[model samples]
Target: MNITPKWWHDAVVYQIYPRSYCDSNNDGMGDLRGIISKLDYLKTLGVNVIWLSPVYQSPMDDNGYDISDYQDIAPMFGTMADMDELLAEAKQRDIRIIMDLVVNHTSDEHPWFKEARKSKDNPYRDYYIWRQPNEDGGVPDEMGSVFGGTAWEFDEQTGEYFLHIFSKRQPDLNWENPKVQEEVHKMMNWWIDKGIGGFRLDVIDLIGKEIDKKITGNGPRLHTLIQEMNRATFGDKDVLTVGETWDATPEIAKLYSNPARDEFSMVFQFEHISLTWQHGDKWSPIPLDLPALKRVLTKWQVELADEGWNSLFWNNHDLPRIVSKYGCEGEYRVPSAKMLATTLHMMKGTPYVFQGEEIGMTNVAFPSIDDYRDIETLNFYKVRTENGVSPEDQLAAIHVNSRDNARTPMQWDDSANGGFSDAQPWINVNPNYTHINVAQALDDPNSIFYHYQHLIALRKAMPVIVYGSFEPVFEDHPAVFGYVRANDDVRVLVLSNFTRESVTVDLPESLQAEQVECLISNYTAPSTLAQTVTLQPYESFAVVLPA
Candidate 1:
């Protein structure tokens, strides 16, 4: 395989969860106008691409992930006109907007699903995965939904059970149906024609599932369908397509991302993020294993160096804030946040900065279960409480692991609701927003926002940052993470102290260079490289060395 340069190869993407980004209207929910107002802010942040979460017409069952209309914008989020203006504004700023594609499932309220549930013989009935009841007249299978409860939902009118890997309201599409595949391809092309940047395909791997065989993801026909979808849709266009495949292994990712495969530009593999999930259970939280995290990330960086691509990210709309997860949110918040950003942004991939992450956003701990809005959090609360888990214990876990932690309103200033909205926000704003906000970060030169801006600038200026080969450094160090990126012209060494204490590591002779210059750091770096150096608590720095 040969490397082909793509526009997105050097671009930095910023993700905006519109519902929490900003609210121009006092309707308590974010709208398209809200995002339009922030276009300047995003531009100032130096991001080239904006990954907008789903805004399609929906029942809001899963916060727009369950789509009812693929072609229309949700009324609560504004009209199609508002969307057009946003696209125009973003394009004018040289920032491409990539919309979320959630074709794995559609809202139960969708016209197709509504008609399909009406009768077994409905033409759209086959659009979804439906199976007859077993001999005992029970569900078709024992599979369970990702949001809890049985995966199969029985339809009284059709006398059949439909597979729903997520919430029941989100019925999975039957990709095996050629008609369904055709409709998906058509929808994708429609979006492409609209001049949108690309797509962040949600749970795309699940589309090729073999329900009867209990294969939920990375199924046998997954690559086949993806290749066909690519050829029929955006393959010929200069657009980025990243599939959300939680089950993608490094080898499998190659099939999805290798240019010859004619599939996606990349896939968001969760191997590194899953390190914090104890025994593969999300609710069972554990401390961030720095060594394991390093190993996983290093593996992806090395394995995908030749044929595939990688999407580097820490927190998104569905995970806890990184400053609060892997870094301390207390005294070392600023430096730690910068450290995390430095570590990820310097890697060999397209780095994504989630909304509010550049401002050092921390996780929120709502006082009560009623305060939470995520279906997954609420379901887990009820189930755990019923299963002998105390409310306090569950809430404790929710503090560290709930998806709601990342959904709080963006902290724009010290004003009420963090200046996100004039009226009450749909969700509570983080109380600490008064101190940690975009306004404060903008005023301070040493803020995390500036750090991110600098990193984005570096990527655009330095070819080595975008195409360098990754080599692990201090791989066994428990409290320190370090890596070297090298190309024919330059070698860059990035190091971060993960713990809240000073750590000293000896430089390997192979990595030692006579000529070294500090490229960027959270702290004032030394003038020259040494055989050994000490890193302060939560400190991170990148240095350019002779190749």
Candidate 2:
């Protein structure tokens, strides 16, 4: 049975956005108790690991990403006791809990930042990056923040400036300080001692910032910092670690996840995820190029084959839903969702299912800007409009690319507020939740949820799905995305149609008319293998070819 204990290698992870997952107290926000209520449901969905978004004490300025305290649970989410209860309950269900670790920056209100800003001579002053203004008395550098405006925030009381790679409320931490590193490592160990599974380190690669704030990420000391972190925390423990890496090349990624280095188990790279936008501008919306996306995916798969590992995902809290963005969401929603699940799950990596993804829940189109809560969306609207872009154009871009699209409340059933709460949710639920929800999906055997369940089971049962070689097939095909995954004794061929029109896939001459097993398919396959196979719209089929 090849029963090794590396559960993360083939396990399916589910991500939960706390404020939107469920509201047990009817306070219009999801809490730890809310998550506890959904544990049985998540277990039914066939996921072994749950990656919860930040529930730490925060000022709610970036939706909990701006943390004022790393060890305490935000009062809005629940109490520290609530978090412990959640961990105990999840462990009983055989599911591991992964917490979000946002160490790159802390909310301006954090005690460390407050103490550091008291005066340059304070013991905590070196904990954060602070620079004196230039000769012109302007900010240290003209570097732009991830949200908008300059990355340097002027401190009037201190007569200097502090760097914030994201929102001004989030000041970047100075990793060069040994005290800072020791504190972070101590906090990580505290969580491990609490019986928590592991962590999802947010924007971890950006910690190694260079001297000039303008040049961000993948700095000179990135690897050293990561290795030091591993040695101090998760290296000897049975814990899972995945770093959120932005703009990281394959070469840089290998260093983070290579087992020999003892850094991380994998990394979440954005190359394939950013194919729909211009490299530097999120406001420039464009159609996704399938060929380009294929090239990026193939590159990562091949490059990380012998070393490191890949964290596969199509949707998360930061991006729009995959179905509405990359697949047809109206008429072919179910088929397209199933097809995407097959393609991602069949690859040699851990698959993540964002909440509502299994039920084919889609993106929302809020009528106006006032309906949105994401800071990035609102910032883009203001910045682009001031840059001469029309209000209509800016809203159009936000509709297509806003992070809020994925932050809507989970669709539980056809009830007031999608059965998520008795009161209105903090964020609006997609109106389509009436027809697309977990209750409705459970009623129908042929649903996106069941298909996902089957796919997860298939991945768990097949060793080749986790350790086999990956080779792209029909790379030049316009509508069909096909690939071959094989080991010494087994070869699995997967064929998926990306478009809503019929397409044909051609097989290699060596395998024509060979005996095969129909392992999985969204639709019934042809009687036997042949030189050519015609696929229906959104059809996805996988078979084991003869040796």
Candidate 3:
């Protein structure tokens, strides 16, 4: 908590999903050299850390999340030597690399799992969560895996069922076993020895959750396990471990950030991101709770500002693109995307950039449910269909909220395959490349890329954004969320209009200056009058205070 690592606290992390980021070889999948090719682009954007999704040796299940070999890169992604080159190149640019740590589970094909399944008495059997089948020889009851069916999959040879919180190919590790914990540490240290930074622990909250029962929705076990793992793996080594805790409450999330807890540097909670579903169930029709989101984030800010940092993100590889999710999707896409970015990055948290997010990439459409390859999205479709929802309706639901929305190939430019691949890409790139791509965005001064680059640079230069105390300014104002971030004499007021109508932001007479200048904005006007700031529909701006 005592100014741990200044770089990670305010660092900009750009996520590179290995398969879709860029492919140097003509094999049609992205590789490490491909990332090396773009180091200058990342350096130009002012990001200091690159968070790459799983490139470990794996079976194709869940993309690369299902690791079959912890120590090797998937041949499709490149070799160990290639990773070394990537680390060297990134280091030269002052960009540290953080790979995904998927130790919570491994591919069924993983040597550990293979040995475990071969015999119940194998030394590696305890590496996974294994249980006996029910009296009826059926898998034990549970809500089901995030992918589909029971969370348990049967192994005929071992005559036992193994828990798979995710896809069948991904078996959960038994962290309760000290030896398992040791092996995980060994793997983590292996990466550390490779000169890479730490990890963006995948589903780390769920990692701690117990295997005694299937999750009814979300439970407490996730919290406890992550703490134990952090103690074993990080333990004051100045590791940048961020747990992925979806559905974790603000109060519970604080525990991970509590310096006394030995949990993690930060944890990702799902309050702001969930606001988009506004009508989905546990997986669908949910309603947006803007006021609740404001309150939740505020609570975290108040509680953990000094003790821990927050992992602020708007998009990731496993969710719908932010532009179509929270921003005005139909007519006001550009303005709203910029506003949403303003609303998010301006807050008191470390910002994470998903691939192609700066250029306002959008959701890609799958012609049908089968066209969707993501396990969670496909599982949701099957569940809704079995619940008597029509196929058309089910597909309609996935179209809007599926995790597949975020997995499309990165659109680089107007090349034959969006410049991602000369050969066929694993997934189709969003066809909006003509309107949205790095090549075009970089050429235009007013493009989202320009805005994001400025945002990242400002964050690096200003301590107020990184170390300032946050206070929500207009909490009670309708369709408006405003906050003031200040550190000593440096003060900045960030105001955003979340609605489609212009809103008035009232400033206290004492705090209001005679005239204010727009430090940054997406609108045509350079600066508006300070007395009565007129925020256009979905407009946002950063105002440098008169200190």
Better of 1 and 2 by lDDT: 1
Number of clashing residue pairs, candidate 2? 0
Better of 1 and 3 by TM-score: 1
- For this target, which candidate reaches the highest lDDT against the unseen true structure? 1
Give one digit per residue, the lDDT tens place, for model 1 in 176-268.
Answer: 899999999999999999999999999999988887788989889988999899889999999999999998899999999999889999999
Q: What is the lDDT of candidate 2?
A: 0.89
lDDT of each: 0.92, 0.89, 0.79
* Model 1 lowest lDDT segment of ten: 508-517
Clashes of each: 0, 0, 15
Q: Write the per-residue lDDT of candidate 2 for residues 1-547, one digit (tens) a residue.
A: 2323477998899999999999999989999999999999989989999999999999999999999998999998999999999999999999999999999999999999999999989999999999999999998877889999888899988999999999999999999999999999999999999988899999998888885645568888888999999999989998889999988889988888888877999899999888888865767878877777788888898898878888899999999899998888999998999999888899988899999999998989898889999999999889889999998888888888899989999999999999988998898999998999999999998899999998899998998889899999888777888888999989888888988999876788855655678777888864478898888889997888878
Best by TM-score: 1
lDDT of 3 at 75: 92
- TM-score of model 2 relative to the true fold? 0.98
Ordered by lDDT, highest first, the candidates read 1, 2, 3
